[model samples]
Target: MELETIRETYQSGRVVLINKPLQWTSFDVVNKIRWHLTRALQIKKIKVGHAGTLDPLADGLLIVCIGRATKMIEAIQDAPKEYLAAIDLGATTPSYDLETEIEQEYPVEHITEDLVIETLKGFKGEQMQMPPAFSAKKVNGKPAYEYARKNIDVTLKSKKVFFHEIDLQYFEPKHLKVRINCSKGTYIRSFAHDLGQKLNSGAYLQGLTRTAIGQFTLKDAWTLDQYIDKINRLNKYKVGEL
Candidate 1:
């Protein structure tokens, strides 16, 4: 793909797949790409938006819409998502993932392979799920995380979500790894919290990597560095040059 072609495509509107890095929020990826695109094309501003939000502790495919393609954001966000997650047994956290420190611990000695498999089966199909308190979901015009940061308690309602698949990839006495295929509003963090209660032991999301969004897979996505380097090369090219 040529530099000019990439710029022109984005100018006309295109969907870009980015493999988001850990510790960087979804907005971080959007801002980085938007900055590079404007510089490469010498545009003062260009509309850029992300289709879905991924937590800072999570890494994986993020669909970015450029120019007029931003209009598809709501539709794209409604698509199903796939994730590979690691859950650490015997402990729980306020935020449900590593984003928060462990607040409690429980015995995992009774957790076994059969028990884990059974639990996985239980989560399959449709159910009501509560979003994590530390989430982007809005609460009375303000984000839930904002209220949480102020130590204010807010009641978040449960939303209906479907888990099409839950494949167990690995299991141990203290940890379990699984690939989950679920609906749009599903929150793995809250799932982790619920899983602990089901097993009568505590659990928290130890790791997570989003592998797919609708038909877009992480394998077909570009890393942030890759996008940046390509943009740099494009910026070096002069007018009328390839």
Candidate 2:
């Protein structure tokens, strides 16, 4: 089903920014787009790829490249990203997200909104951070998650990450809403996780939304349904008109 559609988009090179749905892997969406384009446009084959890999649990802008544009994927992936999230207090997860079970828990008291706001200032600049074990990062030529599945101990070195801004949003004194605009390697999950530790309260990401990636905003992106509709329209109408 996928190969049939890639052939069509191969005829005309174009790029697509898709608003990836939750639980859909980045590769899943990229392959689907490639295949959908080929079948809809009657191309023989299309090389499709995405700018970055968004965790299946996180939903947001995914820059997809078709044909020659695929070569420029890295440029997009290195761009800045923005995310809005809710941090759950009193618990920490191995994955730094709710997808993983609890690794540790802390007492919920002393978690005042003022303390949360003041603590955020410390994360606003550059810092060294270790990626969560249950992540896609490579270790000893293997993905970190692969090693995690085997229950093998893998020590990950901390990387320097730049945080553009970490602002406090609606603070409930328990769960907190915040906006994080940061560099490519900065992980909001780790930020929240570490923030909790610094405050003597464990933390995990309760919610996340990639509001933007570099210049691509959620508004200029397409849903799967909308992409399908556009492709069908192109089939019935002139490509120039589309």
Candidate 3:
């Protein structure tokens, strides 16, 4: 927990649980940590990476691996993930989220609480899912979003993904919220888009927060400020010593 201890162990490896802030990419969090740690530990460079990539529109629990711990990224990414997602019904977007403008709208008048609950149940278990075009999923050696940004039509392949659980937490006429527990590579954005189709309506992701990954929970993660302040304090103490 002390600065000296962290510096000594950093090369060996350290796993940091960060509560990633909204509008910040997972890589942003990694870069910030690496920058501070490099300066604090007086190291020339340090390896840092995140286990999974969270969208800029979403926030919460991001696992950052430092030094030797970077090797664990693959294993950590394979862990099951949990999310709290807010979905906007009766609307659809090209990105299946707020990143893109709504391109269509459908009727939510026929949708009811009972129907929503039943529809959510159908999503459980193994099913094929298509990742959103605005996602980091690679296509032809470039992120799918590259082509999507260029307005280039690109066919995407659907992959088998399993939904461990999908619980409707709240529902309204035009919006609903759910807590989802799913396997690796599951995209909540795509799930939102697909749910609308199944209900004979349209929907898009309004907001999202990753709550957990394997055993790591958002509750146990540190905010960027918290970690930065700690590092700064240690740096001040080191200066005092000198």
User: Which predicted model would earn the best lDDT?
Assistant: 3
In the predicted model 1, the residue pairs found to clash are none
Candidate 2, residues 27-120, lDDT tens digits: the string is: 9998777677767756666688888778888888888887787778888889888888889899888888977888887898888888888888
lDDT (Cα, tens digit) per residue for candidate 3, span 1-242? 45566576667887889999999998889999889888988888999999989989999999999889999999999999999999999999999999999999899999999999999999999989999999888889999999999999888999999999999999998999999999999999999999999999999999999999999899999899998776666645542231
Q: Locate the minimum summed-lDDT window of 10 residues in model 1.
A: 233-242
Clashing pairs in 3: none
Whole-model lDDT for model 3 versus the true structure? 0.91
* lDDT scores in order: 0.89, 0.81, 0.91
Local lDDT at 137 for model 3: 83
Total clashing pairs for each candidate: 0, 9, 0
Please report, as a residue range, the 10-residue window in candidate 3 with the lowest summed lDDT. 233-242
TM-score winner among the candidates? 3
Relative to the true structure, candidate 1 reaches a TM of: 0.92
